[model samples]
Target chain A: MGLLAYGDTGWGDELFFATLMTIAVALVAIFIGFFLAAIFASFKLSSIRILNLFGSFYTTVFRGVPELLVIYLFFFGSSGAVMYVAKIFGYDGYIEVNAFFTGALSIGIISGAYSTEVFRGAVQSINKGQFEASKVLGLKKKVYYYKIIIPQMLRLALPNISNVWQITLKDTSLISVTGLVEIMRQSYIAAGSTRDPLFFYSFAAVLYLFLTFLSMKLFNNLEKHYSRGY
Target chain B: MELMIESFPRLLNATILTIELTLLSLFFGIFVGAFFAVLRTSKIKIFQVISYYYSYIFRGTPLLVQIFIIYFGLGQVEWLRESFLWVVFKEPYSCAIIAFTLNTGAYTSEIFRSAFETIQKGLIEAADGLGLNKLHIFFKIKLPLAIKQSLPAYGNEMILMLKGTSLASTVTLLDLTGVAKHIISTTFKPVEVFIVAGSIYLLMTFIIHNFIKILEKKLDYSK
Candidate 1:
């Protein structure tokens, strides 16, 4: 009863804010994922065999490893990376990389691998004749890409994109390790401090479920919008 | 450096435990995943729906959160502590194994479900036309094909699960990552220790990926 209450003794406010943080991290990850995957997808679809192999290898290596290890690597090695970059620019003071950035990057790279797969499938599904016709119509490749290929890819890629979105949302919970004051970390502290595991965890689970439920609804509507004619 | 050399045996022991945990959990996870795949693909709507939602919840969340819920969350309860089940829950190693397996099972089931559904209907029809019964058709034709189709996805899942075993360190299971953490805390050098740890993981992942490549080639699945 004390655990569930809305007072200071309870975790009502902390849980709410933490859930918000989860959503924030998730959104960041998804946006980054979309951008990275789109580039990789295009590279893979390119006619050059070397480019295709590079894209394939990138996805294969990233997807084959665990997300946890990626996070750990970035988490531990980021300082050195930042210092190296700083030295290149002649700003050699101890500049620290934010843990949030590290966590988001790790999750983004991981999710991007899957999104690359989705986007590649979508890109391949676009009729080859359409691209040829655009070229024959004297539309420049850049204009043709923006005006045609990207839009159709979005439509074809919507459902899978939504699935990736949901995964990214849940994966934000892993930010607990990065010392981010996200929902999982907040609930972890409150639970350990209060010794009310069931109450706090149940709260955390509900928060995750709520975020995912909203995501499913959002994606469902997006999918519906894309699927209107069909 | 001497301390690190001294801790080599302990780290080696922990490495063995970590490997055992990952492989064992993977074994159980694959079993559970197979069952769920069967259920999801079955003609029964209820089973399909139930498995779908279950996998949804598990796959939607991080394994770290899941392990936290199982190890710390469940262990904090008074009743659970006193209950017969506490025997399993009391050990961080056991709890980590259970959590990792359950989480991996959900993801693997999705891979399998996709693989299963993609099995060509024409092939099944051909098998039937050849006088193959359901069991014979499934055992001789469909199952092998589905497994072959799933090998790439399954290989990725295996590596993901292997990487996930590193998170067990948080719950006090001193696997490779755990050893790195302990070393870093002692030497105050996260970079060096994590480099060693990350290299270890990277090496293992590359090895597994090659093995999967070989197996995929052996399967010779053009489709």
Candidate 2:
């Protein structure tokens, strides 16, 4: 307990801040994931052969590879690319790609592959009659999608989106390898310094469990809210 | 390009270790999962509670943290270190297997539990009416139906386990990803090494996908 106190004598403050960092990174990554998912889902739903192939390729590659490898790729690959671009601009100094951006981006790419499946499923589950009814009503394509498709897709996808959220949150722990001082990394530091690996690691697990429990409750409420009148 | 070619055989060799890790843990995970899934559906209140919390804790946290806890945290316990169990906990490989087994077992339990729950009541009642004992009914009827129903989900779990085994590298196991990381450290070429390694993983995933599809077809009685 004293070991977790909130100052120099304890790692509580660091751990708390790291939890917040974990949430922040996960939130950013989920939005990026959702954005990429929309594009990929649309690509899969499109009639164009190349677009469909590209979408499948993206999901297959991302889903098959390990998330750790993806993070490592971004961590190593991003800095080199950044430095090369900087050098071209006559800035020869080392350009560091911060771990937060690398972590969020890598996780975003991985989660995007998953969310694409969810979104595609949601889109496919939309009855053909709805599309036919919209056509008969003479609504513009934009208005049809906005009023008829997107809202229903959101309702259908909410459960799985919550699942993706859980995975994204857990995946943030992997970002600790990129030197982000998230909960896992902070706990590692504390465990190393305190020579109490059991205590600190258990503390980290409890923090993760707390976050997941809270989000599960929140998602349950969201699902209930979205399912209203349906 | 040269580095990728040069590291390809080494990465391929390390992939054997990766396969071994995934298969071994999954083998043990199935039994653990089955036992817990039974407990989850059992009538006893305590058994259900125990199964629920076990899966809840394991599924809630990241596998990396679980690995750290088992590999590093457990080694810190004084009594356990003094005891014979130290032999298992002291080795990073065994620690990783234990961690992966428990982690996958929790997930597998949930899958199996739902599969078991969805087993048609009529089948069990028919078995009961046929004068089979409780054990016989469960082993012969409920288990087979659940296994058939759960095959697709379990196939996804297999791929997830394959991907999950990459984390064994963090525990000092020289798996495919570990060897790739080692190569990248020395040669300073992450893209090529990872591309090769990732391709191997993708190939394995493709193989698993087809294998499961074949199994699903073979098991489909209606077909």
Candidate 3:
């Protein structure tokens, strides 16, 4: 218990901030995933063969590969690729890629693959009659999508989006291997220093469980709110 | 390209280890999953709550954290280290298996619980009317029906576990990804090593996807 005390004596402050860092990274990753999901979902839903093939390939590769490998790829590749581009521009200095950026991007890509499926499913679940009705009323395609299609898609995708968020949040733990001071890494350091591996790791587990429980409640409320008329 | 070609044999051998880890954990996971699933759906409140929390806690945390908890954290336990159980936890391979089994068991229990819950009331009532005892009803009717209902989701879980086992490398177990990481560290070719490793994973998942599809069709009693 004394080891958990705040301030200089304990790791309480570090762990607290690390938990926040985990949430921040997860939020950024999920934000990136939303845009990627939109693009990939549209590509998948489009009738164009090449775009459909590209979309499916992206999803399959990301979904199939281990997330740790994906993180490692980004961690190792991003710096070299950036340095190469820098050299092409006549600057040969090493440009370090930020761990936060790589972490979020890798997790974002993986979550994007999942959320693409969710978004695609949501759009497909939209009743054909909705499209027919908008056309029957002579609405513009833009207006139809803005008013009818997107709203329904968001509503239908909310549950699965929550699922993707949970995964994204957990995936942040893998990013700790890249030296990010998130909950996992923070706990790892604390445990090693204190020689109380069980205490710190259990503490980390509790923090994760707490985040998950809170988000579950939040998502449940969001679902209820969105389902008001339905 | 040449580096990938050169490392292919070692990677292939490691892929065998990866497959071994996935199958062994999943084999044990199924039993643990089934037990918890039954407890979750049982009439007793205590059993139901116990299974609920077991799955809840395990499923809520990341598998890496779970691995660390078992492999590193548990080693700090003085009594457990002195106990005979430490022999199992002493090795990274077994620790990874234990972590993966519990993690997959939590997920599988949820899948099974839903499957069990969806068993039609009439079917169960018919079994009851036929004078089948509780154990008989479970083994004869509930288990088979739940397996059928849960197969698709269980297939997805299998694929997930396949990917998840790659984490064993973090604990120093030389699974497929572990071998790739080793090669990368020595050759300094992360791109080539990962590409080869990633392709192997994709090939494995493709096989699993098709295999599950075939299994689903075979198990479709309606056909």
Clashes of 3: 0
Mind listing the fnat for each candidate?
A: 0.44, 0.71, 0.72
Superposed Cα deviation of residue B3, candidate 1 (Å): 13
Q: Between the candidate structures 1 and 3, which one is better when assessed by lDDT?
A: 3
Better of 1 and 2 by lDDT: 2
Better of 1 and 2 by TM-score: 2
* Shift of residue A185 alpha carbon in model 3, Å: 0.5
User: What are the lDDT figures for the candidates, one per model?
Assistant: 0.81, 0.94, 0.93
lDDT of 2 by residue, B1-223 (tens): 8888889999999999999999999999999999999899889999999999999999999999999999999999999999999999999999999999999999999999999889888888888899999989978888888889999999999999999999999988999988888887787678998899999999999999999999999889787
User: CA RMSD for every model?
Assistant: 3.9, 1.2, 1.3
Candidate 3, residue A212: lDDT = 99
Q: How do all models score by TM-score?
A: 0.83, 0.98, 0.97
Docking class of 2: high
Best of the two (1, 3) by TM-score: 3
Instruction: Report the poorest 10 consecutive residues by lDDT, candidate 1 chain B.
Output: B188-197
Which tens-of-lDDT digit does each residue in B115-178 have in candidate 1? Answer: 8889889999998999989999989888898889899888878887887898888898888878
Candidate 2 chain B: worst 10 consecutive residues by lDDT?
Answer: B181-190
